[model samples]
Target: MSSTLHAEQPGTSSRGTPDRWESQRSFDELGRPLRDITFTVVDLETTGGSAEGGSMITEIGAVKVRGGEVLGEFQTLVDPRQPIPPFIAVLTGISNAMVADAPPVESALPAFLEFAAGTVLVAHNAPFDIGFLKYFCEQQGRPWPTFEVLDTARLARRVITKDDAPNCKLSSLARAFGSTTTPNHRALSDARATVDVLHGLMERLGGLGVHTLEELQTFSGRVSTAQRRKRHLAEGLPHAPGVYLFRDHERRVLYVGTSKDLRTRVRTYFTASETRSRMGEMVGIADSVTGIECATPLEAEVRELRLIAEHKPRYNRRSRFPEKTTFIKLTREPWPRLSLVKRVLDDDADYLGPFSSRKVAEKCLAALHDTFPLRQCSDRFGKTPSRTPCVLAELGRCLAPCDGTVDHDTYAAVVRQLRDSLLHRPDRVVEQINARMEALAADERFEEAGVHRDRLAAFIRAASRTQRLSALTRCPEVVAARRGDDGRWAVHVVRHGRLAAAGVIPPGTDAHTYVASLRASAETVAGGPGPVPVATAEETEKILRWLESPGIRLVDVEGEWVCPVDGATRHLALHDAVARSRTELVPFDDRRDLTPVHQPAR
Candidate 1:
């Protein structure tokens, strides 16, 4: 996989980074009550361009609303105690004569603060108004109130297209929306017009499934104009856990994703936080958004994996081709040797891992050679041919299997030892390396020890994950359950390491009927193939994680899962205790506390 900054590596494109990753980011609850939120929409007329440019507030107007009802209003003329520029007077019509007898800004600030306390602040261009008010409040020896601010300009960019209004200016939007209250540049009239625009935008957003304050505030600035127009694609999607498909005009699937709230997740594509240019391009061509409502989040996730594999959509970057994943296999040559291969077959050879990335595989391979006496040669032998011992043999790192110095029987014994260390007893390798690291550090060979230390960490991460995946894949059948966002239980059935059946079991549903129906439906899918190959390694890892989630109950299972006990993974806790205090980091006594903890039962 190429490591391009903009393009994701293959088998990883389907997943998002921490910021936008579906599983990483928290979701809004099933039904977020948007109407109950109170908002204080404020506007200000200033004497000049900006607060930083010696401008002061000339007028203040705000309207507080909740559930579409006007809670209260605050309006006043503020004396800047300075001359109002002619350009400002012409633009806002708030001239020196109008504010000559008005109360000073000190007097108007308090009343507006009282009206806006404990509510969201919104404005056409929020920074200017908020900047003016916040500066004066501080100048008056009062603590500036912290208020969540929303910009109507940003929201307008998301909701109203340039075609609808050439620009999102207040006058343009007012004329376009046909607001009865026209903005004549006065503060109160403009604020009233903004209120109308706010209501109009909210009405449009409601149809697009955007109903929360957070959603409205960030929708416009981040999403492109083309994406905003396609909000109608999500008009009919249900607000539940499910999968969504973004399709082109030719009915080609461009992207696929799963979310607990399909409507909200799909709407997020056209919001401000979604700043990926590639996603913007995808949205430009997407003609429709389609969704499939699943009974549970687990079911939705499983469906996403299958769909990504089947479609191989252009926009999707991850899990596109599991077939390309590499495995570190011990080749069944005249002399058994470790080698990286793309596919795992029925060849009589032992396999250590089907690693996710090649970088890690190479690190583990290099570390393994350091600990075990294995031949590093590329010669394929039909019969034992006469050859000289290489440099690795001279350094005592190899047994010289290519030469007559190490006989076949003796080399075979060494290969068996290496196999034992890799498969069942990985601690033999970790403990050996740890001892060497400790020795080097004692002799002030710090740089060399650090290399071994990093190699230890790499081996542990790779081995732990490999062991967990192998444990799940070895089982014939397993059933688990986790509570859904709603008051229901989501049951997942796995057979031969693939998701066979998954459906919701409501609190009061009949247990026997649910199981029967689930099994009948699962039979159609589970019977497709016997067992997944190394190509489906990602599925095995995903299943392992799902099985480890909290509150998961084991409804049924088959076979005992054999776990590796004496590995760097299980020994990591011991290493961690001493790993702190790098200045005096001494390897503590080897301790193994990696006990198996079962998921919670219902």
Candidate 2:
């Protein structure tokens, strides 16, 4: 509450507080013109400080104006039906005698409301006046009509510096703006004074290019002419769920965004709400915005991921180079060791990932090595033994297949075990981890148990993702459809885990003709012959995502499109246990080399 009984915006702090005001009202910049706004500048003189403090308004005054011209005015003294306090009567010069002949508040309020109807409310410190009026309406059991409110105090703070105007009080602003009418606590005189203040703040806003009712409602001084010029880009977009592209002068895609309401979302770029520095830079270079309307948000999301993969737009920092996504593969060399590679080679090799990045692939690799005793050595080993065992062998992390310690047949069996663990039987992997965890816990070495628990969690996470992705990759083709806008069907054809074709089948058209046409016109995203790799991690991910979207009808599917009955994720109970143990700080962590939080028993 303020000294003048100013109520804060519903969930915000006062003017002197360090929180930005939260406001929401619908006003389109292009659709609703600001010049047509019927502004009712209002003021009130009350007997007490606060509405809730049993205060009653003595006088209500307002001026309705538009385009710098006064349309109408309202002023009235109300018989509070209660005695006015001595200080308030003295301050407002509205004594009991002055209002003796005045009508009671019950009758006067209706006339005031009629005069102020269909007008946007304006007040220097709005909450105080509005609060009093609202309380009166509530007391009379009359529902208060809602009005779009503009606080000159907030507008002044955004426009004027503290050095120019020490504060945003109506009298202070009126005097600063060189108004002839001085506020001396009389309601009509003060309301008239505030009208000048309102116009003065609007003048400041106009200089800042906030000409629309929408722009002024969300006023900011940073709106540049260049940014505002781009508002036209959003003007033609439909208010539907879809993906939007921001393209530059070269017709190169600079940024891509998805929105349920394309028009509103794209228009926000020019407003003050878009506080991201990179977004401003994106908007500065952005010449046009194009929208691709989708039937569902899931389709929009999938489309966004695919576009990000294909274009690799400069402003899109993530998934741009889906080709850069790495994979962990067991090579077909004589040694048959694991290696992280970018492209999935044509050579027959056991592959695990399509991991999001090199770091994640490396992390998964490190986690896998902690449990599996496969050959960690990178060198090719013929039918004979190569170099002696290395440090990893000494640490018992590797099977030492490079030495006679592990024979060729034995190493081959171990390689098969690792392969089975990755592709088909992660159940064995989960069992081995649980056994190790149980041993650690039985010895009362809980911290080590925690370490084991965390490693199990990481291994399961990587394994689960890799398994899911590999399943999709192995599918020869998948055709799916979702209901599109205007009663159409949005169809996607996936070949070898990449978008083969995409198009819409209109409501009245024969579906087969459009599908064939779409496939004919379809640009090859993947499965094209070239030196450069065509398919991407994101492309496969997009197909998987769309398949997983709710209400997706599977048109057709090829290959074994099913999860293994005994797949790695089957031991979901183990995953749950590991998750809980880690949370209890059975103390699972990745920082194994860091300082010991507790000294475990030897």
Candidate 3:
């Protein structure tokens, strides 16, 4: 990175004596006075972009400088636990193999933060790096530190003579300063060069008596001129879903973002109130804003994902959050055992989670066991059938499907009940629990009622996790497509009112085409609503075939749009719209005058 800017030794004023330089008439007209200040210049490589959606940082570097002199520096490689794009590897020369052996981000970020403490941040493009750092810190439950930021590129344009230079590049500045060192693209080198350039700008501006860090932090270019440019850029933006890139005068990317409405989102940062803080600082650095329009909201999400993945833009947060959070998997087997597993595992088992904690998963399982009474014993114990039932049977905790006392069909029915409970249909669980609790209470079985009450609480806890409930008579399915404003599309596969999977298709593709493809694939399944085959009565399979299929994405499922790919049933919302429209329609004969002759009766 520093190769772009040549490194210079400290205390070397290429210009005349400081006092004489300050007296220059040209410096007084064009520059602000410079002040001694400390700055922490930082940079990061990340897995992807959107902070909220999912992205992680892979590396970070920070250099501390005071009064144009280097104090210390910090740098580290982060293991993202995800595949690194080939281009990023080539550009940063930090390969997947390199990071693969490094400590994960959890261990590296805190160290970087400690080094960055107590200094104003300086970056070639500060917003991109700082935004990502802020977002990542927030996700880790760490407090984000606030600091003034100075953009070297912005300072260059303001202080450098346009007549003397054809272009304002870090390399050009390094060359002009007669510095021999070339900064490498790696974090440290770029940060170092940025530091050098900042020093040079300060030296030139010091002649104008604008000599303190505080003044630079609050510096704004010609008020009317800056406002006019901001307004012009805001006016040119279109109201569409798309990604926007903010760049400074030196053409370094400052920030990348996706918005449902580009014009509105971009314009917000230009308003008077927004311009006073970090965003204002960014605008001050930015010479132009560029946009890439997406055809639909989903396409915008996909593009944002791709860009973040590709560029590792500093401001995105999507990659920093945990991707393998744990959840409970209640197998669709005869025994229907519940087990804890990470959400990212590739196992041939039915799973549900990305839940916040294991306690929540356990509570849900316990409630389901109480309500459905499915066989919870291990298969080894179940097959060991003794003359008397196991402890579970004695405690009324199992229906004893093991001893042939409960038929296979009956056991399967119980399993279905357990599955429904796991799917968050608490009404049935509540009704059954209420009846059992009432029976025990009426019989003076106070202990049993109390146990049932505890189970009911757990049931309610699980139900409360879901935000919506579907009222479909049978399992619901939906095929929905989200088209981005740039014509890209995202196809979602929903099953039993849950988001099962999603796929991104190329831009300009029709939403209906992808939905139709999913529908065709789902139609081949045997027993379930999806394309997975179910076991026959003779096959006492340990797991349901359809439940183990890899095709399903398995997200929070609910509503009439369950299997959106099927699209056989229309949502009530759509029906209501049609109904309302029909009622408002007027016949042509009643509203129009057919005769050209004058209306004498009027």
Q: Which lDDT tens digits does candidate 2 get at residues 1-602? A: 55566656554555545343222212232635567888999988877656786667789999999998889889999887788743344345677888888888899888988898888998766877888888888989998989889877666655555455565566677788887699877888988888888888777666555567777776543555678778888999999889999999998999988988999999998876664445677889998889999755656876888788778888886768766667788888766788888777778776766666687677667656765777776677687776778998998888787776877788788788888877777766667766776666556555666565555555566666666666765666677788854667888876766676766776689877876676666555444321123456555666677789787898778776676666666644445432431121111111111111243568
lDDT of each: 0.72, 0.71, 0.55
lDDT of 2: 0.71
Per-residue alpha-carbon lDDT of model 1 for 530-567, expressed as tens digits? 12453276676677778888888887787666677774
The per-residue C-alpha lDDT of model 1 at residue 145 equals 83
Off by over 4 Å in 1: 1-221, 382-386, 436-451, 523-535, 571-602
Q: How many residue pairs of model 1 clash at the backbone?
A: 5
Model 3: per-residue Cα lDDT over 2-47, one tens digit each = 5454455454344433545545754555533343456788766655
TM-score of each: 0.56, 0.54, 0.34
What would the C-alpha RMSD of candidate 3 be, to one decimal place? 25.3
TM-score of 1: 0.56
Could you tally the backbone clashes for each prediction?
Answer: 5, 0, 52
TM-score, predicted candidate 3 vs. hidden true structure:
0.34
Which candidate should be chosen as best, given TM-score against the real structure?
A: 1
Better of 2 and 3 by TM-score: 2
